[model samples]
Target: MDFEIREDRTAQGRVKLSREREAYSRLMQQGYTNAQACRVVGIDSRTGRKWRNGRSADRRQKAAPPINAVVPPSGPSRYLTEDERLHIADRLREKATIRAIAAELGRSPSTISREVRR
Candidate 1:
């Protein structure tokens, strides 16, 4: 038996279905529902279901972590006034943990650490 590939029906010009399927599978593994994965990969929900069911073969695991699961840039630090820096330093001198300082300032521990380290 011989099979002929259809040149005109090829996915060369658009995103490959295989790639989409893989991405869908990966998203599902990462806890995204089929609907959510479909929306992220820009495919119809039914198609996503089909891919998940193995009726089709688009099997591209998502190459990276989900966008929603990633931490977004927190943006630049607010310039601390001299008094504020002194206050933070004073708190640190008093042996306040980074968590304590961040809680007091309502910021992240990383922010507090960076501020004091500078």
Candidate 2:
């Protein structure tokens, strides 16, 4: 028996293949099924299934940054109370810049700007 293979003549063919490869690898690493990984990586279920079954041309997932090593910025302080706003406003009207007010109150320049604007 002879089998005839059809070739994809569309640009989506290669992109779909690459997506399937990426999705399948992530699925294996994250301990998810093809369908779940496909959902996460934005690929179709049928393509994901094929990749999971070892038709994948590539098998690498993008590594995420270490969560523990990530340093989130220290957020604005709650020290700028309503009373502080009244005082800062009084100071700004006395010709104090937002930076000066921020330094005096130990807040961000943006904080001072927002306070005066509001």
Candidate 3:
């Protein structure tokens, strides 16, 4: 089977469909929604949907991988440390309130609440 590749131009005649698809995929990978990515790539929302749903007219197999499969940036987490967790546990045993614990640790009450829940 012989396949001839022809570039499909967009309305602006500056960008091609292939380029739009590539941009869309990259945007989606960076946590953009189909519509949002499509807008950024200057393509229609329906086209973005087709790309996301794997119904491309060109029959190309372009699929974005799972977001979790994409490795996150390596850095120190902006979260409570082991010492903070130990302090939280000690405070909890002492029947300290969430707000009080947060005040003692200079953290938000919600942070303490979420940490305790975890």
Candidate 4:
């Protein structure tokens, strides 16, 4: 409770809470119940639960992972295909806007612009 826990803790790096978290994990490994570890560590029972199993909309299950808005750049499937490059070439020759070409190709304008640049 003394430690200020912001709701928006995503990737914030809880260096302040790390000591307590480590102690809680140690207690858990030694067969202490969730409540007992929380009491000893001076954090709330719910905070203990979040530290142990993660938060969820449903209290019984772990939190669902965030949905990624974009494809990861590393995969081959994310790359522009030969046909897509040809389409870009054709669209450029016709003087189509980058956004228009991107919309037609189902890609970002940056992708269309980058292809045009190449």
Error in Å for residue 53 of model 4:
0.8
lDDT of 3 by residue, 30-74 (tens): 799887786666677876776676542445764543223245746
Candidate 1 residue runs with Cα over 4 Å from true position: 1-15, 56-118
Q: Per-prediction count of colliding residue pairs?
A: 5, 0, 0, 0
Off by over 4 Å in 4: 1-13, 57-118
Off by over 4 Å in 2: 1-76
lDDT of 1 by residue, 1-118 (tens): 1222334544453345655666766778778998888877767797666556644234664333222324344653576667667878999889989898778767778877888777
Please identify model 3 stretches exceeding 4 Å from their true place.
1-16, 56-118
Question: How do all models score by TM-score?
Answer: 0.34, 0.34, 0.36, 0.37
Q: So what's the TM-score on candidate 1?
A: 0.34
Clashing pairs in 1: 18-58, 22-59, 22-60, 22-61, 23-60
The predicted structure with the larger TM-score, 1 or 4, is 4
Q: 23-83 in candidate 2: lDDT tens per residue?
A: 4574556577766766665567775555545352345743322212233446655657777
Residue lDDT tens for model 4, 1-118: 2433345545534566776777777777778999988887777888777677655677676474322224345433667999999998898889888899888878889977887888
- For each candidate in the order shown, give its overall lDDT on alpha carbons: 0.66, 0.62, 0.71, 0.73
Cα shift from native, residue 118, model 4 (Å): 57
Poorest 10 consecutive residues by lDDT, candidate 2: 62-71
Give every collision pair in model 2. none
